[model samples]
Target chain A: MVREIYQAVADGILVGGVYALMAVGLTLIFGVLDIINIAQGVLVVLGGYLSYSLSTRAHIDLFAGLLITIPAMFALGVVVHWAFIRRLRGAERTSMTLLVTYAVALIVEGVLYKIYGANNVQLSAPYTTASLHVAGFYLPWIYVYGFLLAVALVAAVYLLLYRSRFGRSVRATMANETAARLVGIDTGRVGALTFGIGVAVTAAGGMVFGATNAFNANSGYDLISRLLAIVILGGLGSIAGALAASVFMITLESVVTIWYPTWAIAVFYAALVGVLVIRPRGFFGRKEVRAQ
Target chain B: MIGERGAKAGGLVLLVAAAVAFPLAFPDPAVTNYGVFAMIFVTAASAWNVFSGYSGYISLGHAVFFGSGAYAMGIAARDWNITGAAVFELLPLCAAVGAAIAVPFGLIALRVRRHTFIVITIAIFFIFQLMAFNFSFTGGSAGLSSPFLTWQESVYDTRFYYIALACAAGAVALSWLVRRSSFGLRLRAIRDDEDRASGLGVRAMRVKLSAFAASAGLTATIGAVWFYYVNQVQPQTGFDPLFDLTVVLMTFLGGYGTIAGPVLGALLVEPGTLWLNTQPQLAGASEIVLGVVFLVVVLFVPRGIIPTGGEWIRRLR
Candidate 1:
């Protein structure tokens, strides 16, 4: 029983890393743009589809496929910003973005449905099925690799935010866009690039997700809810908060499933509500809105 | 003042007359079906507008409120023996149940920042749908059906249609009243600037909570009436994202923050959607079209159908 519990926790942490990476993209967009991209969920699905297409049609490995999918997703993000997001402004910005992003989601969902035909597809790598036994607990090799990728990406994101000159500009824009512009930072360019980078990371998450689950075009609906919950529970624009919340939520659900399989899902949402009621700003999130 | 009030009443009469007469004149069941669906959607949209448009809170997952009302009414009518009550009676019961469930949910969820609030609400709805899917008592994915009460076959059928009409009317009237009331003013204030509203001696929490409760209550009533009209309610069907999307789309297309915007959206788009649905080639393209419509509306008339119309009216005056 203890060993099983340990395995669940181990598995939870591994998968939670990937979720954290996906959620960071969502948080970064919200933090920088003041626009909640409902399309992020669908974008992840898009990422999965891209990877799937590359792996199946081009015979690229799932990890190797990211080499192509990442930049492609980044470009798509820039186009989305120019096409839809750039128009939103003033008091109507938030509500209007919801509508616009939702439209983007539906469009992607439709195209995916057109191409994929609503069938479930999974990425079948040898590592996906292989397990490692460590400390008397079994861990999937895919999860381990996914976790490592997540850590590297998160570290790179941290470096981009803190260590690099571009990172300083991005942070300045996130803190105060008007001030960033006044200081010679091309805030518009930063916004577009941040959005693109936010979307680009989803390709990695998509790869891991495709490896883990049987997904179709419609799977985004469920995935969106979980990702949204993670971001919200972490606090909307806080990357650290998203990371913490993802671990907390996934672990809770994973651990709870051991005791009550049917009730595990409900428990995660219930925890979100409970946590918010107690501390609305989330575990590490600040209450102030980020500069767009 | 009395004359103005009378004029408003006359306008309402004219509007109702036109709606009732149009179907009879057009003599198209297809258009009437759209009208019926539009009226239903208007109820949901008005309910959504209370929390979203009025309070300035974007809820990505209003399906929770709609689903609550649906599941509660479905359970009450299916497992219990409650059926054939006037929609007024059934509606209030559903509304109360919905409010009761929503208050705690709102209390818990409303504490979060704006974007998180939206996400958490969606998650909550997801849980509701998943639970309905997994549980046998909720009929799993197939869902529950109202038993064959004698009323379903009799005058009750036509009466149910009238009930829907009455409910829609109530929702529109309520939305108008709330939009003009002091509560509505405070809600708008909160939406525009929560901190400023708090500074101005408004208890933002109380106002938002009230809006949440009222919206949940109204939408729940709509849900109960919906189940009564449909005869059967399934988990997947009842909790479908399409329903939520329709409500959001209608509210926006009509105009967000305008009491009448969602109604106007229903008027314009619902019939078009119904017509589009009939096209063999466009069968699955309804959602795509809706998305396109949303994009067009957001990019062009961000304020919404009624608000923009109001602006045009002001310009003409």
Candidate 2:
């Protein structure tokens, strides 16, 4: 029983890493832009489809496909920002963005449905089925790889935010957009670039996710609900908070599933409410910084 | 001014009379079925508008209340052996169940900011959906059927149509009343600026909770009626988050926070979607069109039709 519990926890941590990777993009966009990307889930699914097509048609490795999908997704993000998101202004921008992004989600979902015909598909590779034996426990290779990739990407994001010049501008914008603009940060450029970078990370997350779980276009709805819960629990715009919350939630869900499979999903959300009641701003959220 | 007021009152009376007589005028089963769905959506949208439209706390989880009401009716009919007249008797119980769920849901969810609140609602909604899928009493994913209403096929659609119309009218009237009350002012103040409202001695939490509860109850009542109308309840059909989104979109498309907005939105969107559904070539076209319309409306007419039209009229005058 103890061994099975340990396995569940181990499996959860690996899956949680991928969740963190997906959530980081959402938090990054919220931190800098003050807009919740309701379309983030669909974007992740789009990344998965991109990877799926490349792996199947071009015979590219799942990890190697990111090289192409990342840039493509980034460009898509930039176009979306430039076309629809750029025009939003004034006090109602936050709520308006929610509706606009939802519209974006619908359009993308419609396109995916039109092409894919509502069938569940997954990215397949030898690694997807292989497991590593470590200390009398079997660890899936895709999960291990996914966790490592998530860690590397998260570290890369941290370095980009804290160690690079562009990172400095992003932080400045996140801190105070008006001040960033006054300092000649070209806040609009920063917003667009940050949104692009945020979306780009979904390629890695999506590849890992699709490899593990079968997904259709409609899967984005469930994915968005889960991702939103993770980010909210992590403190909407806090990167580290997203990371911590992801692992915590996934672990809790796995643990609950071991004992009470029926209530596992409910427990995940129940924990969110329980945590928020004690700390409404979330784990790493600043109290005064209301989502405007 | 008096003439304008009289004209407005006359228009309202005429509108009500028209609405009450609609099913009679068009007794075709197809038309009545469409009317039933339209009225149900309008009621749900109005219920959504009462809380989200006024308080700026957009709930993506209203399907929870809606599904709860539906499940309540389903369980009562199936488990408790309630049938025929007893099925109608379960309406209040279903509504109370909705309000009951809303109390705890609102307590937990209302503590967060609007953005976070939206996330919480989504989370809770998924939780309910998952529960519905897992719990055998609710019949799991296979779902439960209401006690088959023995109404004749000829009058069945008409009967449900009137019930739906009544529900919609009650919901709209409730929304209209709320909008004109001090509670409505408090909700609007919270939407404008929560900190400022609270600073001015408004009990933001209580006001929001009451509105949320009221909205849930009304929505659940409609959901119960819908369950009976459809005679079946599935997790996918009952707690579909997309249903919540559609209602929200309808409210927004018509004009969030206005009395006529949700009604107008339902009028436009419901039939439009039904028409799209009927077109054999356009299987998924409605969502795409709705998406484009949503983007355009948010970008160009964020204040919605009524307010924007009112502005246009003022400009012309």
lDDT score, residue B18, model 1? Answer: 78
Interface alpha-carbon RMSD, every candidate:
2.5, 1.7
Clashing pairs in 2: none
TM-score computed on alpha carbons, candidate 1: 0.94
Cα shift from native, residue A28, model 1 (Å) = 1.1
DockQ of candidate 2 compared with the true complex: 0.67
- Please compute DockQ, using alpha carbons, for every candidate against the native two-chain complex: 0.56, 0.67
- RMSD to the true structure for each prediction, in A, is 2.5, 1.4
**Model 1, A146-263: lDDT tens per residue?**
9999999988898899899998998998888899999999988888999999999988898898898889878887777788778877877889999999998898899999999988
Residue pairs in steric clash, candidate 1?
B254-B261, B254-B305, B255-B304, B255-B305
TM-score of chain B of each: 0.90, 0.98
TM-score per candidate, chains pooled:
0.94, 0.98
Please report the candidate that would top TM-score against the real structure.
Answer: 2
Model 2: which docking level applies? medium
